[model samples]
Target: MDDLFDDILNLEEQYYKEGYDEGYKDGAEAGRIEGRSVGMKTGFEKFLEAGRLQGKAIVWQSRLPSQQESSTSAGNSQQETVQTVPSPTSQDGKDSEPRRLPPLSSNPRLEKNITMLYGILEPGTLSTKNDDESVNDFDSRLKGAQSRVKMIERAIGEGAGDKGSANRNRQQAQKNENIEDIGRIPQRTDVVMGTV
Candidate 1:
């Protein structure tokens, strides 16, 4: 009968449609999971770098001489300096000798650069949104902060002359290693396979 033959011929097409629909659904779900994981990893790496820069800025700011000291020194260059000896015991009876960091040399330009660096890296000013504008803003701020770090390092004499060249080489090598780490992420092969 005609009806029986027609049904048999349509059977293969029906199965093909069902298989295609299932494949599409599975692929969509898998893609969503993979995309979310990659996004989270990327966001974590970016924020970690920002936090590291923020910590550096805080340490640098603390090392700078206080404004009061700078102003008084500027007003009286010939005054005799008095040194206060630290007491061995505090009021709580604990050893009070705290390790002190050497103050950065009082240079106005250096101070301004340090301030700018801190301002750029202020956590409140950064946004975590993934929209195009926010992403571009975050990227630009990150680049600015990185350049500020290099400038600060140079200002602090870490990048001075022959010794500085060696330090710079070491830094470059470290940066290359970081790049290689990022590159180690597996690339998607779906497009190539689809084309084939």
Candidate 2:
């Protein structure tokens, strides 16, 4: 009986270690897969965001020529001022050029996108963050994106409603125009009654 008890105890210990090892391996594999999937998803989102920002930049670039022309016109006025009066001197006693205020940037969405793009493009910026921290960051970004999308949807809906009303108004105007044209036609006042 003593020998049997000792054998049972040894068997129990062996099985327990085997079970722990297997569980640990399985958990590690699952963790690795989860981490990889999350990383890929985050990377793809960043890629899309970068592309969006690039598109915005392109739009801004296309508007640059117009902006420059306006600025040139403004510059002519500035040149008149320069000729009449010297700009205020700084503490260093050098002739300081007049500061030209930048053009008013009206698009908040574009600004935000550019700011986010800068953050994304910063060098080695995300290397120190761990997986859990990254997951939290992703959650925050997703929430912000969702809100932006909702706002866009609302704007689109309102725009569609406005277009529908405009279409109806246009159709009504056309109908009125047709009626006016019919009323302007000449009526026959002299009908011949000699034919049977």
Candidate 3:
């Protein structure tokens, strides 16, 4: 009689336990999938920005006159400057002369900043690990690279259109896009609907 009553009395508790276990398993699986998707998207965005910075650094380095060129120029101040346009071969093996940007004015400070920017963004040095330390380091380096880019842009008078505004417009536009992306994330309706 006691055994019969025990089963009858605990029916609600048993169902609760079973439901809890099932919900836990489902929640864990869903969380894993969502976490992975977000992680991949974030990692790709970070690396894309890093690659952009690296490319900028390479171009800036190329534009800055080399020490040899500077020395030669100093010695021959009267001669007209000659720009060597490299005939970069296309992927189809066609001879295509790439449009060359005029060299940046030779400034010691500008050259040092460019070199520093390249060093900070060196490809091999950045870690792709998702650990806390690596992520923090990557963020710091990225911020540093961005600040350096703004400084370089200011020095070279590239991105600043209006006086005293250095890339702020572009940065603000990017921030707005990111905010819109965040707003688009699907909210969990199952909990609200009492389905979980």
Candidate 4:
């Protein structure tokens, strides 16, 4: 019958469509794998760029003391002389030097090995030599750090409170279990359904 033949054609088309969809899904998954690899490469590139900048900044800082010393001897502005570092010239001639300022000495080790510690931390801001100019961005960052410390302290306090509450809850739950008559418990159901 013609009806039977149409049904067979319909079934064949359905199977073909299913196979197409499965192939599409497989291709999409393969595309996703390639996308993930590209994303990872991009992330790694960004990390490397940040690290390079940090290194440049550190190098700039290391050379600050000599500049400071020169300025002091010359009776010139101390901060001013330190600001005039030459262009960075790496071994590769790809200069990353004087352009970048050293990160500051926030480390505890500054008391121990002054030279070694100074080698690590450099003045990030060239303009931040005096308390006047240094007070701008440095002030904000210091405030931010202070706020972060407070937040951490608050979090620790909150965590302790939550632990105490959870212990109380657990004890209550255990008490309920102990007091309940488990052997002769009755089965009950509450149903609220409109559509049957």
| Cα TM-score per model | 0.64, 0.36, 0.66, 0.32
Record all residue pairs in model 2 with backbone atoms less than 3 Å apart, i.e. clashing: none
Q: How well is each residue in 49-107 modelled by candidate 3, as lDDT tens digits?
A: 99999899998887887844664567478445544345655555455443556789989
Encode model 1's per-residue lDDT on 45-159: one tens digit a residue: 9889999988888888878887546645664774445433465555653554444567888888888888998898788999989899998999899899888888888788753
Q: What tens-digit string does per-residue lDDT give for candidate 4 at 1-196?
A: 3576787769988999999999999999999999889867864664454344345334433435554455357645444545444454455545533453343334333222334323322345323343555545544544443343334324334322456777988898886685456465666456556744
RMSD of each: 13.0, 21.1, 12.0, 21.0
Clashing residue pairs found in predicted model 1: none
Cα lDDT tens digits for candidate 2, 1-196: 3676787779988999999999999999999999989978877776566456445344443334455567678878877655333356555546566554343344566445534543443335434355778756655654555454344324334322466777988898887686568668676668667754
lDDT of each: 0.80, 0.57, 0.84, 0.50
Mark the regions of model 1 whose C-alpha exceeds 4 Å error after superposition: 1-3, 7-13, 67-96, 159-196
Report lDDT (Cα) of residue 65, candidate 3.
73
TM-score of 3: 0.66
Which of the predicted structures, 1 or 2, would earn the higher TM-score when compared with the native? 1
Better of 1 and 2 by lDDT: 1
Clashes of each: 0, 0, 0, 8
Candidate 2, after superposition: displacement of residue 125 in Å?
7.9
